[model samples]
Target: MSCGYLLQMDERPTLDDIRRAPKVLLHDHLDGGLRPATIVDLARENGYEGLPTTDPDSLGAWFAEMSNSGSLERYLETFSHTVGVMQTTEALTRVAYECAEDLAKDGVVYAEVRYAPELHTAEGLSLDQVVEAVLEGFAQGGRDFGIRVGALVTAMRHQARSMEIAELAVRYRDAGVVGFDIAGAEAGYPPTRHLDAFEYLQRENAHFTIHAGEGFGLPSIWQAIQWCGADRLGHGVRIIDDIEAGDPPVLGRLAAYVRDKRIPLEMCPTSNIQTGAAKSIAEHPIGLLRDLGFRVTVNTDNRLMSGTSLSEEFAKLVEAFGYGWDELQWFTVNAMKSAFVSFPERLELINGVIKPGFAQLKWRGARPVA
Candidate 1:
């Protein structure tokens, strides 16, 4: 299991080095990580031609550009094309299967992909049908690739169907749906708008995460956790704003509570920069938060938009924050600990998958670093 080149001396670290480092992904989006070639083919097959470029590479770049315009609403527009082609069961299954294969290849042992079922029902599939197709794809992919996958059925913040989506997620809990989430614009559509759904989820003993502190600020995060009962905070990057850099920055009440409670922060470094949530990757507060004992996990919010994979995200963190195998392993464990999967299953992943992977990755030979 020892790759002689596991540690590239003096190069920082690289995707290759980290690719063998077991990781867990908690915040990836299904419609946000479609293969460029698949999108092109899907679009062509469905006779829907609205893409800026037909070529796979060019279309990939187009999605990235469209998502980088500094406006959350504008960034979400890119998904119109992705979700458009994902309406059919076959397309959804293919995307889900490919998503698992990609994560497996990138060294992720566990992943939970989230998407709003309401958005994919445009082609007449029921919520149950969409969930079934996605689970089928994930199950097949996991069986084929050895990557454990889970689904999060999200309710769009702008919609009034949170209760329905929460029910769908709870209903499929036994069938591989791990949790529920609220996505879309966070500024106007606060988690309070989905209180009923959150309440129902809590009563049903279902786990849920919330999209907060990404587009909005501390108020949004506070409401999501304090009010709506979110288990984790998606891109809770703005919690830093509530912090005061007395000499080296002080965590406010909310930040301190999040840290003390061990609420996981699903931080996507490149995606935060792309969405203007963080000015730069080096300036991201994840390092500080992690240093302060906040459960911080790296993620690819949208691979296509951020032009990043799980390995790439880890490589960037190493380059920017001097993270080594220990820190990388810590992040992986943090993710697994914070995942919505059951306690026994999560522990199994850590002991059986992550620990062994890192044991092999901490090599001293010639692996290339950043």
Candidate 2:
């Protein structure tokens, strides 16, 4: 006789299983994820006096506080404290090393951590020195934990250093720096403001992503892709606005173009909610996009600020969308595919690591009960 559950598919990975499953991250912020204890230690060492608290747990809660005003300025003010402490090479390297370690322990097989080189130059470190320090830490951490990590050099969109930062990214392309990005308020300062930098990167065949459709609207996303030639979009949850909701949703020209072109959308549910981009995980556009076959990828945009990790992000989607192992694998594969890594390298990871990892989890879940 057949077993009672043999006909059923294994679904809803337990929290433990989710944590154990291999994950890929492409939008994590380095300064955004420092452990609260690390912040205290770094602040003490650096003589930085701006911390709201000295205790780890309190600092964690403090950092996680969502601004009541919903002002982008207020949202960005939190980074000032983080960037304040991360002025020296030691602080930057320590923060980066712990980043890789934490992600690896969370079952992240690969991650592209990003930061602005200009932000860390306050302690008199050159842009090159800052990049080197971070690369060193990621290398050491990756070697120690058996995880692969890459860097994305980000420029503040509202600043004038994008051209200079683009040059810095190109100079370190052979190093661990895998791509370039422009992040800041997307309202007035558009990606086209840095058109020269984008054009240079395009000439060099370099990769880049733009922060759009999160703070602004469809116009920002249009400029990021059509004008600036962004390879991917950062926190592109706002693209859903272009879709008319229905039993069979209709995609506007921009939405259809994004889907037809398979442009990757780095959707951060918790972060979106924190910033008022989405009301909740269940109401997030990721569900609709995923259902529509958009190349949607999950990410923890700012882990500490959002109080999330790749595993936790996936678990949220799992609960909200009833995602099974297959859905998790799809998201993971989408991220790995959209990574700035070379084609061959991405293929190796998809076949050698992510696929096998999910296969094992699926297998374990599908087994009959004793």
Candidate 3:
């Protein structure tokens, strides 16, 4: 009996294609992607209390259920549980280290994991201590797992601590912090609310990616780019609204600017559908945006919440859009090119790690027949 999977059986890629592919991740949320078993272990160690279930399987289902409600408020509630357990230095270190290990296992060669330091301060640890512990964890994880990891310090959009988080990111830039970000609901709180922090990052010559256009629309993306000077966009999927589709598409001012300027959009297909940003993975606008020359990269916004990984996200795209090795390679290169790392560093990652991986895949077997 046929399982009726989306891709043609003959057209499906080999395991070698999946295992050997190079990947880059830019839009993951550290608080929303914890392994269920790790959460249980951490909770037990900390005695911080309150889990819906202690059993790992039950807890896993609880997270998927809670996050699937499609209300941003309900979705965000799940993070409270993860963040609550990650209060102490030891807990923080363990979670960060496990995050690296998980990503490495899923074939993510490079990643920029993000979390809000303000969330960890509830246990009375200073923001600086939180940064230091997480950095140490990622450093150790990288050495142990052979994956390159960096942290993106996040500021909650609904809160008034962007300036403080901005300072914290700058303070830890040399230690493993690579960039800054603003996340959370975009409907009521606008990007301009945190203009001072963005301005501060600018003066310090720091980089940032804004969470815009996922649940909201084009204006949020416009302000994040034009007003706040974001280096990249998180879930800028809704920018499709500004472009009229045709044989040759026509772009509005904002869409045209985004494409012409080659701004990188971190598009997470499954999370976009779960969060009600897009209707379906098959209908996502990434292909259109990519065809139009905008720099688009695939990502798993919240791996646990979305039940996905970088490899899974790529597999879904291959099924939905018939993307083969070449397309996947281009997207990975796009992510590396758009990463917040310094020029020479980004070049080295692409040339030294990413391109070589893809080159090996090309020589491994016969190319999949179209």
Highest-TM-score candidate: 2
223 in model 1: Cα distance from truth in Å? Answer: 0.4
Cα lDDT of model 3 by residue, 263-338, tens digit: 9999999888888888788889987888888999999999888888888888888888887777888999999999
TM-score of each: 0.95, 0.97, 0.94
| Residue 68, candidate 1: C-alpha displacement in angstroms | 1.8
> 150, model 2: CA deviation in Å?
0.5
Weakest ten-residue segment in model 1 by summed lDDT: 1-10
Tell me the whole-model lDDT of each prediction, alpha carbons only: 0.90, 0.90, 0.88
Q: Residue 217: error of model 2 in Å?
A: 0.2
lDDT string for model 2 (1-370, tens) is 5654331453578788999998999999998898999999999998999799999999889877854235556667788888999999899899999999999999999999999999999879999999999999999999999889999999998899998889988899898999999997778998999999999999999999999999899999999999998899998888999999998999999999999999999888888887778888899999999999999999998899888899999999999998898899999999999999999999999999999999888777775754
Q: Residue 108: error of model 2 in Å? A: 0.2
Compose the digit string of candidate 1's lDDT tens values, residues 7-76.
5545555678788777899999999999999999999998877888889999998888887887777888
- Deviation in angstroms for 283 in model 1? 0.4
